[model samples]
Target: MSYCGHPGLMPIEQALNAILTEVQPVTKIIEVALIHCLGKVVAQDIVSFVDVPPADNSAMDGYCLAIADLEKTVDGVLPVSQRIPAGAVPEPLTSGTAARIFTGAEIPEGADVVVMQENCSEHDGKVLLPPVLALRDNIRDQGQDILKGSVVVSKGQRLRPQELGLLASVGVGSVPVYKPLKVALLSTGDELIEPGEPARPSTIFNSNRYTLRGLLQALHFEIVDLGVVADTFEATEKALIKASNADCIISSGGVSVGEEDHVKVAIEKLGRLNLWKLAIKPGKPFAFGDVKGTPFLALPGNPVAAFATFLLLCRPYLLTKQGVGNITTPTFTLPANFSRKKAGMRQEYLRANAEVVDGKMMVNTYPNQSSGVLSSTCWGNGLVVAPIGQTIEHGQEVIFMSYSDLLY
Candidate 1:
């Protein structure tokens, strides 16, 4: 295949959507306790088996009394029949009778309303009641929270803490969910040394692994670390073969148009490489293709470029491969706090911090923005996306994409 010939890079969103639209979900069904399914994406919708609050219950520590039994004690107190605490089913109520009940306790038969203890006075078996006694007050209606046979959550939705509780409440012990995507990560560069290892004067400590690993973990992808490989055909080729078994392969460095960059060559020898020079800052040399049918994503050598490409490109493709729905990214618009006049036809994502200034959300760019400077990425809460060829002035609105997204 032709490696290059003025292949214009698509916009970031268009590029991402193209990749994800072609992939499908990779998951199977598993029986697990609801407690373990939190933070997992649902493969199928959960239907409620039973109504929440199976029976009407007390929602407060109060007295359960028939509305007819309510009396304005002309001179003295009214009689109390019995007491019904939580978990106890009291005998049927008689005329002009009242039962005491606690929160979460099943309401006794023939009782329709519960008056808070503080709202009524009790002396001996006889009770002095308030003039007004309302029906269904402080009573939890059956199925109020959920209904039987109803879909609690749709398929492809991520389960959260509250979702787990809801599923457990409905007695769902197991759920169908998509399995995490399995990925193999490799870093290529002869001048790269692993963190904590002694490096020569010309070498820099490896950081791509940590950056890639963190993003993978956030996406809940199962990762296989291939470690660092020197820029040689033989060394890089071996790693590529090892990663061939993965659902996808990702590597940073060596994909650029440099003589020492051997990732592209290894990709060509192993399978294919579709290198695209993106018209964007910090992330330009991005290569995406395949290795023996397994998808491959080759990121630039700079740390920031690797991170940006992963977010702007690989993440969507990976999510597509995982069969995720609602794959569009979340974008928010806020006023620009600073002015930027540079004009380009490609979208620019600058590291920025957002804060509420005078009750309005505003974003400001970080001081230093170099592809190798990963610290700016770590410090940024979001990215300020300046439109192509648009000169943004202070107080003008700009689109912002937040890094607070838990999912990659």
Candidate 2:
């Protein structure tokens, strides 16, 4: 079917905005240990109770001395009054003496500067110093890294490794984070069979189930697997009813306009379904609505189409609903090494490999761009986005998005 000049078809951006406007972020919050909060969104701003490196300390293993004492000596030397190792406190510096200090040791009171041990030598209970010394040299000031009562992490920010380390440094033992979203996953097709089951005539093993599961898992959502529902009105309606318990509902297949496709009708019966004909390749028939107040997303039946649509459409919606501050996927433009003779009516996401040829980075697509061919997706590390009604030539700039950025 030609989607060109179709009045009912929605542009990709319009459809995404419509979906996002209808959904609200989950408000439930839970306290999680700092170590277990990776990939989880923060429910509240985390403020530091104490400054990092609470006290002034040494930046190196050196000697602490008063400047006045060095000036009194004939040479750059002073008597060693005490030894202060890391984690040990020292008495106040004597009027005319130096203290042997190690890295991370707290600065002794009345000491003006720390001279590196390498720049000084010890002989017969006294230490030699450089003639010219800078004040506060090799000394880390208190609150150098973080100040008390400052927000270490803001609300809606997803916790990453570096964020976790920063929180740990400020002695944050636990944090309040949004609860992981629960998603109901369903698949519909009469001719579908699960893997490990005996193969039957005219039956294809179900791959959408596994594909959707992996995508949901990568987002850290709790999946309520509804398995494969038979291609019947009763079965589809029953599945939709059960799925309404989750925060969101996602189904593959049975969304297209075909006699065997019953998901659209079933969803309408339970609540409402806004079936959209999107101007996008691989995935065209997409459904977004709510099932008994729970948001619903229905993807195309084709395996490759399901994968592409999930990344392009469903991913951002899910992230926004989970309270993520930044839901946009990162993309960059690269020169195309290959060419297409004819322009397509719908926006195309071609499975492509990007490499550095000579000194410039170029992208090349898989030989076959068929939606049913799942192997094409496995062969490429990223997708080259071709705009609607646009043709490509060699060395032309094209937008590229990586799976590494999309999967999470």
Candidate 3:
């Protein structure tokens, strides 16, 4: 896409699809206990053998009785013939009886309706159901949620806490998931220094290393830290060789056109380097290729650019490698409280404070849109997306995405 004055830039969407097309999900799969599989992608479809609830059960604390008994009983009342707590089996409801059943208690034989306790009155050992009630009013039927032989979770689904609970509900104790990707992370530049170490002359602490580490850890990737490599073709080539065994080698910086930037050249010398200027505001210089058969993704040196590109582009690529098919992020349409002076040819993400104001979701832009302003990323809830050549007018409806979202 021709991005404004920058002529040879690729659209961000096109770049994302291209990167995804070149990568494949890890082939190794392992079976783990359901609890351990939280946040892990399911490698295959999981079919449930047992139905959720297994049998008809009470959905609330109430009285269970035959529907016919409810319509014809005197004062819609019946004697409490039994009390069935959750997990307890019960005898059949007698000709004129009601069983006291708590939530999750199996429905007794011959009982098809449950009257919530609030809808019934108890006096002299008899419970009176409301005059109006229906069959199975408060009963959760067997297989209502899941039937036997049904797929509980399809392949490529990331198992969350709720997913774990759902698997347990259907008697699934273990899950098959793809092995976590082994990622070798590195930072480049002679000016980059490690944290807790004294900085000599014109050096700064390596923040991207730790930041990327935390982000990748949250995504469950096994990280191999190659530390910071000095800005030299030999050093860069050596780092790539050291990390060649990793599934993906990720390095921040040294991929631009700067004469001192040697990572791109070193990668080309050892393997391949396809560099592209992405049509994005903060993130433009992006490199994606392979080194010794292992995929490599290089982000820009700017901190904010690295953050934005990792979340928008590299994060999705990692998820795809884990066999996740639906790796898109959530988004919403909201009003923008700020205005843009000029429209840029490339799509832009403005970090901003998103809050519910006057019963509407509104985002006010963070003043600093600089690539180095990591504070902007922290202050804003997510990105306010302005499409190509689209300038924002105050109160205009703009697309908002949470830091957690993958743009669709």
* Cα error, candidate 1, residue 395 (Å): 1.2
Q: Can you give the TM-score per candidate against the true fold?
A: 0.92, 0.91, 0.94
What is candidate 3's lDDT per residue for 110-157, written digit by digit as tens? 998888888888888898787876767888989999999999999999
- What's the true lDDT of residue 24 in model 2? 97
lDDT of 2 by residue, 53-91 (tens): 888888988899878778888988899999999888789
lDDT scores in order: 0.80, 0.91, 0.87
Candidate 1 Cα outliers beyond 4 Å, as residue runs: 1-7, 71-77, 406-408
The order of the candidates by lDDT, greatest first, is: 2, 3, 1
Two-way TM-score contest, 1 vs 2, winner: 1
Worst 10 residues of 3 by lDDT: 399-408
Give the clashing pairs for model 2.
none
Q: Report how far off residue 58 is in candidate 1 (Å).
A: 1.8
The superposed Cα distance between candidate 1 and the true structure at residue 32, in angstroms, equals 3.2
